[model samples]
Target: MSARPTTEAERLRRCRQVFELAVRDRVSMAVARDRLARERWAEADARLSAKNNTALCGTAAPAFAETDEDGDARLQWWQR
Candidate 1:
């Protein structure tokens, strides 16, 4: 709110407005507000969990192997 919620009435009014946004966005469905809220929370939690996980890091590139003058064995091109 432009003005701070200095009174309990003002605080409640702002709180209700915030809750109304969820209904407007369909995060709280008309017939199942509580269930929809849970689903919405679960989805947000899952995305946050994935974003913070160590396993999501990209793998490093392998270094090319040194070869002799013969060049018969090839560099690291054929290596796994």
Candidate 2:
């Protein structure tokens, strides 16, 4: 298989190509898409709900963790 597209432009171009092919084939697999989305959401929800630890503002989002030690860890790269 070919390597995955690395750039945003290349990824969008690939998506357009896939969309065109799907349209030409009249392949509207909405059920599969819905199922996949549901499964993904369930998995994400499970991860977030596990151990009753759902506070994502501090654990998942780093931008809001500017004063956190973990957030300041990126400063090492900037300093280097």
Candidate 3:
């Protein structure tokens, strides 16, 4: 079977999981730090977009994100 992810959102979730799967023999401390840095940057960018993308979010405003297959309000890794 092809390794390609079925959708962009699925690929994103899988990538985030892989990136945060630290504390194992596979990833070094420096790599984990880099991932955290990238994650922080992404959070900042999202906050900015949340203010700017009013049309997309509408009444939900800055806190808007798509529900996953299980219908979760939070799917992104940074979210609780």
**What's the TM-score of each model vs. the native?**
0.27, 0.33, 0.35
TM-score of model number 2: 0.33
lDDT per residue, candidate 1, 1-80, as tens digits?
A: 33553888866765676577666776653435565557769997898687445555665446799957756466455563
Reference-based lDDT, residue 14, model 3: 55
lDDT of 3 by residue, 16-76 (tens): 6656666654797577767766987999788777745666545553566785674454455
Q: Is candidate 2 or candidate 3 better by TM-score?
A: 3
Minimal lDDT window, size 10, model 3: 69-78
What are the runs in model 3 whose C-alpha is more than 4 Å off?
A: 1-21, 51-80
Query: For residue 63, what is the lDDT in candidate 3?
Result: 64
Arranged by lDDT, best first: 3, 2, 1
Clash pairs for candidate 1:
none
- Winner on lDDT (2 vs 3): 3
lDDT of 2 by residue, 1-80 (tens): 44674888866765666566556667765644455457769998889787757475556433543456556668887888
Number of backbone clashes in candidate 1: 0
Backbone N/Cα/C clashes per model:
0, 0, 0
